[model samples]
Target: MPAEEHPMIGVLLNGRTLRGIRRGSTQHEALQLYEHAAARLGCRICYFRLRDISLRRRQVKAIIPDGPVGRYVTRMIPIPSVIHNRAIHLTRRAQARLGRLHHLRYYIYNRHTRYSKWFIHQLLSKHPDIVPHLPETRQATPTAIHQMMERYDTLIIKPSNGSIGRGIMKLFKDGGRWHLQYRTAGMERTLRTRRGKRSKRRIRTRRWAVISFRSKLPAALKRLIRQRRFLVQQHIPLACYMERPFDLRVSVQKGDSGSWQVTGIVGKAAPAKLFLTNVAQGGTVYTLEHLLAANPSLHPERVRAEVERLALLIADHLDRHLPNLADLGLDIGITQLGFPMFIECNCRDLRYSFLEGGLWEEWAAVYYQPISYGQRIWLDRQVTSGTAN
Candidate 1:
């Protein structure tokens, strides 16, 4: 089939150079996924950085493969009918550039903030069903921290824009003192003996140190608060697997029918003694079935049904606010009492958890669903133009 016969679909990426033919590049991986789906859906797909688009020419200099298992070639193709954004970060300049291409539609619309806990809390607060799942959260002011600490036995202080469990501090009152635990880049530990008993090891590091301090509020924590804004959330006692804290990751995507559906749900277990279950933070992924088996006391079917229902509801609700959202990766924590808690939502969700759990079919669905949605948009445009003519 000729490329001209199909509507063009542009995959917006982060980098300047295109490496669709080179293995391990964002363009390469995206091209590989889009190529198969484009063939089936009858679309011409190309990978282009945001700067590659030319409004004057009404075309994009994109990296496109010559053929299957062939070299990559650059071509000035007509501006895409739709764009599937996979860029992790979009600058103001890039946003202005994309804004110029107002005629093209987008699957994943805008870059969402990682500090969106408070934003989402406010959005979901209107609905009673979702409110219970939201933990008590507030802007990390001194007063807010004091209030939260007074209310809850344990509190979590994390950066408003943090990811991969970075800049997170778990605080709890142990007897008369407050204890803070957090992860850092690298730290040296030394064992000291006090009164003929081995004392708790002390850790020293120049950078963000993974250590615990017993005091009212450490100087480091105060510096952290003074440096940038943070969020103080009431920590929930999440269920555990083999003594490691675990949480459920529900992947929801808009299907070809334009309805939200749960694509995959897997459990992520943190290393022992760790508070976070982020896979990037040395956490392990487990199948839902495995998680259910580990906790036989809870009804597996009931939990699965409830989680799916909640995930769909969240996706639908968020869609009202984010109209162009094609998919979401929801981090939901199931408490020991079997209550579901919303941890966070990722607009540009990482799909490696699905792949790690041997869910290739579901992972593939993530790539293909956007293409199908884009194809529908293209077909609608053609129909509208034809009818006008």
Candidate 2:
């Protein structure tokens, strides 16, 4: 099929990503991977922002590829009915635009990427199978925090809308005193290389502080929770790798047949003594097999099978309950006894762990899955409307 004649699928991006593309920067996103994946799947992709669409005209000024070149050109095209929304727009006006698009009968998967963590926990709580895996969670009220602290020796207090392990705190009791450990916002320092080629990088050195007090919650911690919506959950004693706590980031996504699939699983080990295993927070990525091998008690085959089953079940359950969800990154923690514990769910999964873990095959497939899934939806609609090419 000719490139121009292939079915067009939309890749909705955030304003930052659109501007980055316009500025010839693809750092914030892997635009090349998306382009390559679309090409491999025999589909044409249009990259556009929500504001680029004109609802009245039903057209979008989207960026499309030029013939045999890596360059892109802007052109007007009908609003693609099949849109994969990768942006998280929190403003009401932005949300209104999304609602309007849906009203216009656009097929937008992952229409709402961000969801309240507390809300999702409640949704999963209703399910019996999931309940066993869920860590006890509650809205971050003073009473809830106090009561939960009494039940568990350690608790995690984090913002409901947080991502990449930012704004997370660890509360634990030891030696007749309670300790609060959290990362403080620190300045970024850039190091220059021996060669004169200067490059900027965020300083990996994180400043973590520990505060201690007796019995009652610290005024500082209490004030922090009051500032925004937060969730206090029981801290799962995650099984460790090299004696450092780690968690598995499972990429569950829709495949070409529009069915949920476990695309990849990678282990993220936290920095020494840190409570976070988020990649952005300097966590080291390792192959899931390697992590399981280090923890000898867990049977490799049994643990692998259990993780897959649990990931699929969660994805399927969330798909039925949530609206238009096709991709999810679940942070699943395993106990020393190999029990899978659901830590957190990320709607926008940044899939660097696969690449970092040297799983090139899975890394490539993560990029291919979304476009392939989009192609599936577009073809299904075409068949239904008798417009198949």
Candidate 3:
């Protein structure tokens, strides 16, 4: 902890990611992104978890990324003025702890990252400009589902806090019958006689299936909806590439000047047989330019402009309600006629999709943007308090 060192920006990860950093084996989040960003942005990175904070001492045992990759130094330093939250805090206790930190005058941007899908929809519904871009959404009650089915041929049922396309159900009615498409994770099997059996063996899983109902909504589906909070939305027909439906993942963030900007956009196409276009669920990523080139009918310039406009509008509107919503990954769909439709909003964006799409510069910019934004917050806090950052 040298005073001569550059100002530090804290990165708060979950316990598992913190341990992986100690072992130098974390794969999901590329630690090198921060290393390179530090060199370019002139701000060091301080990696810590909630448990690492010591309020009584007013300091934290933060990991400083120094030397080569997979190398760092641990020091008991005063908590950085700015923090970027990378962890999902779902429990009541976890949230209260974050609140405690906030009360201590810490600039924790994107601290409350996990907003429910239904909550976001409700907020955006009030904005006239953003309403047409949003699909029709309702709580997943049996009565609501029946009412929606009467109006729209297809609907989407998804968990309020789901991610990566998990816990999503697609429902469509055809020929006076209702069909549902969903996926199940690999099923588990138990072997009582472990001495003579393979206890780890599992049934073939991670496959998609469809169930049909003739006259009424299935009882099991109703029970599932009641067991957990779900939201139903009218399914928007998405533009297709290679005969498969696709959507865009737009990366929006506040830059050095604290203004929202669209940093990158990548195309996510559903698998040949699957309906969800999440990369975790057998989806493929393509550059927007490449996708537009393959589909000759889409006007690239118009589509790009509209997408940026909608993304910024959504970001600005959400920031008014959500505190410090500086970074977001929005899932927006495009119709055959080239209109941007809202799908979902992710507070803490995983920028890997840009890397997968082969947009190297955009991918790097995604990492560097946060550093620049954090620096802005740090500078502003100092000016407001008449002290150093």
Candidate 4:
């Protein structure tokens, strides 16, 4: 390839981390993480503050588009060979800019689509094989929540566009009482509880603790225009390894053979009794095999094939529904009966961290290349059909 054609992979990160995530005057230890990964792939990462950047056509063209050669030479200007979306927060301006880019291969942790969670679940629901693994879910409204509570006493409320275990609530029956538990910072509190054992009752506050689809949905949609909506799901009894509720994260990547490969399996274990297992929320990570060995009762050997099956199932779903998706970070969990269930999938989730743990070689296959070879075919189709425009 000519010097000018040497695939320019531009990483658009928030400007807050140009030199990497810093504190006051000290560089964060985590900064090295992104830098090392970017160095390995020879990526020219540019951190742009989306709030400062607008979607105005003139501004977008000035910052992103190439010269006249890129504009008129091709009906659809070829996108940069690789666009690493490291954006933490999304604004309308950023979404508009991303929508205008026609020719680049871009990978986002989250998409710019409205009702993204609904779209993702819709695609996942279409897979017959995966249907059994997915927990029964529906849009949460005050009425729907009441209906779900009738069947299953416990329900997990999650912000559709949330990450790292923020804004998650668990409502369930505890002995003689109904309780609503949520997290703020790292500490947890039972914000409200309906009359239970009077002796154990501790704090009584005047704060109104209510979960409503009627109010939250509109506010969430506007507040997180770049993020997806919230989801209310039936809580699954996740398989436990080492006395902690364990969830499996299967990172899948597209291979040169045009098939999906299992990059790595990370078993996320929540600190005892917690309903969620996110690393950001005091969770521990372990290898799939190790966790299985510790929990003989889970009978992972019998379900191993199912894990691989779901990985491929998710890859196909992303390729079909979200045409721009190049890779998927699949969150899967196993119940006490050793039944595999789908938790979530993200397009921008990273795998290099798995590599640091010596999990598997597929980590290199997924993150090292930045863009999947198969996605190029989709890009070509988008250009030819003018859908990417």
Candidate 5:
């Protein structure tokens, strides 16, 4: 088959320093995996930054790997049939540029926010099957916080647009006193003596701190609410291993069959004394088998089945409402009683978690699955335009 005849797929990234298209060092492995998949599927995969696109020319300068050395060579290629977005956040200018190319299809759509949490909650609250799996979440207000604290012993406060477990706080009532444990940004000062000269060095870090409040919310917590919108959720009592709470990260993606499937599911455990189980926040990932083996009391088969089922349900529901949603990562908390609670859904999930866990095969599947989906989209477009034989 000719190169142009093969379906073209583009991976969109965030970096803008490059003149045309180039893959960052971090994306090297992903580029190789995509190349492997393209060869197997007889498609063309290219990596392009948003700035590399020219709407007037209907072309993009895409980075194509040369050979085994993985040297990237740039070439001006026609706009791809579909784009797989890997950018963390899209700026307004980028969005406008992409909007101009309305003909190009995008697999993964927009980023999900805490407001999306409230929207999903409202949508699923009426469903008996889904409502039980969701925690009570609302826009954080003084009145809402007080009411939620009264109903549940513990409540979680999270930023509306936060990721990687940043800006999350746990508020709980301890007898007559209220306690809050949250991660805060602090600078660590280190004195160094070099070449007979002493110097002071400061490094920024996120440190966890605990505060006690009496009869009222702390002024710090109140100020945070005023600064940004937050989501207040009833904290679920999660199942633990070695006395540290853990949750399941289930990734669901659109497969070649055009259906949502659970691509990878792993247990994420936070370090001792920490509440968030995000891998970025000093958490560790464990395979399902190892996690289940550690907790013999939990039913491995049943929990796995329920997690996959709920993940698919959530994915399908969101796909129906939101167009161009190709994949999502769901943070599900399984209670000690084996009940699963919906934590949050991430649109732009990090693939490194799977890679770090040595699940390279699974990671490759996730990296290439979008390409397969894009081929299908291209075929459908051909048929719609009466060009297919």
Candidate 6:
């Protein structure tokens, strides 16, 4: 083994340049937290973009016992002690490349598996505590959608594989009519223009609806190689702040004691005229206390308890089923009755939410330093045996 590849304390973040990407605010927050944690732990951390780092499938397989099949099992990687997988948009080649490096003990805030998407849904479906918070939901299809439309006055169709609230649509029904509303590609405003006053004239300008026909989104997305399918969920008619919907983001990281902890909590309020509370759509984050206080109907303590419980539950569930996840950023929402619903569990790009004071201190103790040093011993033994043969 190379000297730099020694069993030293450090973290490897897997992704691209943080600035160029959309929805970078959350990414920047996470990167900063990881860097701070790495420093406090007396460890070095490096960032690698899976898209940039070239890898040959055959080469990665050569190091493992069952070859390519070992990826499904716990194997070792050629380099590094810990890997923080932050690759939000994974390419087919990148997925294959990372799968083979199982020996290095790559850590994810969420599980990266073929059924990872479905696993999230399963958690929501099984957990009675969180299920009541969710709106009426079902798998998406052409035939099943009409029933959803009938049940709910408004609905949302979202791409299962997407992130940062991209390719999400919000639908509304008025007078037995349906219209789609959404934010445009860029934050553009629609203003009525008139050179001079005309006698009772009407003008129509093209505007992107939050809810759009699947045909208008992109066919190129279908061409991208994927491990699984998409989902159609019931849109939660969120309690609004000035007529726009909002949601809460609770960031959770694994503590060094092999437990889950909530690092930060932020309530994301959507921009004016937008239904989604995604930060990419100019949403704002507020302190949990202030947010709950603003809405007197919600019980802040209960919501916090539920958030903490669900975070641990998801972390435990992922660790039980996948065993490789280190962190999870759960998107949760509150209904009028102060019920907490499960929006989604994002394992891919687990962003940090440090709304409270000294949030980094808590994060440093857990994520800054790795959880298990014992895994390294077994990895070394395997490498030694391979060399001996």
- In terms of TM-score, the best-performing candidate is 3
Q: Candidate 6: global Cα-lDDT?
A: 0.54
lDDT of 1 by residue, 1-389 (tens): 55575676677776732553455455324446667777788776778876777777767788886775445778887767667777765467765665556534333343332326667777877778888888888988777887887898799898877777887888888776677777655666666687666667777663434444453567777778989978999898988889888998898876568788887888899888788888887789998788778887778888888889888888888888854677688999888877788888887677778777777787677778777766776666667663110
- Estimated TM-score per prediction? 0.86, 0.93, 0.95, 0.68, 0.90, 0.68
Q: What is the C-alpha lDDT of each candidate?
A: 0.73, 0.87, 0.88, 0.57, 0.76, 0.54
lDDT of 6 by residue, 1-389 (tens): 44333333223334334332233443344444454554344343444444433244311111111212112122233333345555553467656656655543333333262334445677666766556655666655544566776677777766666667776666667665666664455543444547654435444443464333432333332332133354556777565665556677776666555556776677778887776677765677666686677777778898889777776776676566664666667788877666667787776433434432234554444345332321233245447653211
- Shift in Å, residue 222, candidate 6: 15
Tens-digit per-residue lDDT, 1-389, candidate 4: 33333333344555555323223221221333333344454332222334433333222211222232112111122333334454544577667656555323243323432335556777889888778878888776656666777778788877776776777777776664556666533333344445543344345332224433322333432343335456778898888876789887787765334556776677788888777788766777787777888777766667677787877877877677665554567888988888888888766665544654466464554554344333343355456654331
CA error at residue 332 for candidate 2, angstroms: 0.7
Tell me the lDDT of model 4 at 87: 52
Residue-level lDDT for 91 in candidate 4: 70
Give me the displacement of residue 51 in model 1, in angstroms.
Answer: 0.7
lDDT score of residue 248 within candidate 6: 77
Ranking by lDDT: 3, 2, 5, 1, 4, 6
- Model 1 bad stretches (over 4 Å): 16-21, 27-31, 103-115, 185-215, 386-389
Residue range with the least summed lDDT across 10 consecutive positions in model 2: 196-205
RMSD of 3: 2.1
lDDT (10s digit) by residue, model 3, range 193-243: 546865765556577778999758888788889899999999998999888
Better of 4 and 5 by TM-score: 5
Q: Model 6, residue 148: displacement in angstroms?
A: 1.1
Candidates 4 and 5 compared by lDDT, better number: 5
Looking at model 1, how many pairs of residues clash? 0
